[model samples]
Target: MSGQGPMRVLAAMSGGVDSAVAAARLRDAGHDVTGVHLALSAKPATMREGARGCCSVEDSRDARRCADVLDIPFYVWDLAARFREDVVEPFVAEYAAGRTPNPCLRCNEKIKFSAVLERARALGFDAVGTGHYARLSGSATGPTRPVLRRAADPDKDQSYVLGVLRPDQLDGALFPLGDTPKAEVRAEAAARGLVVAEKPDSHDICFIPSGDTRGFLAERIDEAPGEMVDPSGAVVGHHRGVHDFTVGQRHGLGIRRPAPDGRPRYVLGLEPVSRTVRVGPVEDLDVTTLSGADPVWLVDPPSGPLDCVVQVRAHGGTAGATVRVTADGVDVALAEPLRGVAPGQAAVFYRPDGGGDVVLGSATIAATA
Candidate 1:
């Protein structure tokens, strides 16, 4: 491993402090680097609404400026059609089927690692580098094989979204910001004279910049008004669409009557065919066992039970679990119940280690109990 030669790396510049600094670090390490920004919308917005969204004209320009400062070649790749096909449309379809899909995870799986990495290899690059907060074991050049691990910054760990990646994808990938915290990244960007040093991180979903998800969904899905029934099968209220409610939703149940025991009602389940939203006491939301499909194993496919920690959402809670690999998916029995885990959400697995949890595998939750 000593006296390793410099590698060719294609850095993804997202016009943010982290990405700008990531590109700088790669160049500082003497690797041949180039910058690229993804244009995710066909007709990109002229500017971002503060820190609400990204991939806008302003963001592209920012990325280009950073590339110029670093003296690296830069280009914008148009991936709007691919994004719509892979992330957006499937999001709508999943909601229609009464599932809560994670679009960011889908974007990483289909767009960045799949679409961009394929193109990068064709152009004679060694690996596709990003500002993602995740780590890989073994060599940094990516060819020696590496196991994905959690970032040093636990609060910003992005391993959950990246759990879908296969061994081939990991082979030519680089994450320079995995070991650094967010605060230090910003300071580094400012010291490097990057213009986006203080640019606040975009918080909302990219497509829905308005931050009104319900309004956006309502426009795409037709209203199928239905009843909101209690656990005992008694009608308590009504709603316009099953798409309007997700499991574990507490407010806006439209239930005029209160429970006999005076407990707050939460959405327990959705029946798309019946157009029914099941409302019940909060205790019903606690799910202990999860059955999933589309399993992606970063480790060897285990034939028996494996002890691991599982995360149900991007920034939500995680719990200790025992996982059994199934023929097509996984059976995870949680050590403690997690509230409101729904279908179409990823169940990312990690094995507890010394520094941070090492990503083992992931799957799409198909059913929960």
Candidate 2:
């Protein structure tokens, strides 16, 4: 994607202002750009109005209209079948196994980068560009070895979700809007006369457009009611399903009694087999060590302990930590305890480089202590 000469770029547009601006930027940069809107939903009529995020039927039309204004070829690729098999099913399975899964990250990994990029390359496209708020750096040679970096706007930085990408995916990826702030992008969209300039950013999971995640999961998986117990295994309350809870959750636990110390009880663990929701003081949620599986490295895999920043969630769960590469996975020693580190969530490691903390790599959390 780091070619100075014009290159054939497949721009993944989700009918959002960010994507529209991204495609326009690429086109202005003189690349042969084609806009593609991925159809992830089998039944678009059932989705929310105006395609919030990337799953709605209206999203395709919006993307088409943007392409028309930019005077570029546009196509809607139906990836619903693959989306269901790769992203949706795994999401449900993770929750069923008593863990929280970030489907947005999964979509970026399985669909946008994997499926879309593969198809684009088969059709002779050089790279795939998106509106993701991340930067790409490269060498001076013709075969630009692109390296992923953080965006200028920290609030809208999406490097965490894109952390699952490998070095090859990095070479095939382009983030045109990375250096630009989001406000400037919106302004550029309006100036360009794009239709989606003012479209509100989609925050909810695209599949669960209604934003009722628990309700959605309940419909997919059978309810296995269970006991809510204290750290000592004393039954404090009852839960309808262990899948309805997650580590560090303090609300909607359905626990009626206050703790002996009069503090709100937080969920510490979920045992899906026993359907047990273990609750205790908030302090119990804090842990210093975490093990992550199936690591994907952006840089050379470390042979020994490495110091970096650790982020457990999409936003705000961050700590300075030391990472040790293991035979099966990675062992992290947090400089300070982080609360609610749960299995199935990606532990994205970053170097403390002032340039947006370069994304070192990521691994799925397998266990925590």
State each candidate's clash count.
0, 0
Cα RMSD, each candidate? 1.8, 1.7
Writing each residue's lDDT as its tens digit, candidate 1 over 112-210 gives 989999999899987788888988765635346568888888889898888888877777778888888988888889999999999989888898877
- How much is the lDDT of residue 113 in candidate 2? 87
Off by over 4 Å in 1: 1-4, 139-143
Question: How well does each candidate superpose onto the true structure, as a TM-score?
Answer: 0.95, 0.96
Highest-lDDT candidate = 2
Candidate 2 clashing pairs, residues 3+ apart or interchain: none
Candidate 1 all-Cα RMSD? 1.8
Model 2, 37: alpha-carbon shift in Å? 0.7
Evaluated at residue 238, the lDDT of candidate 1 is 90
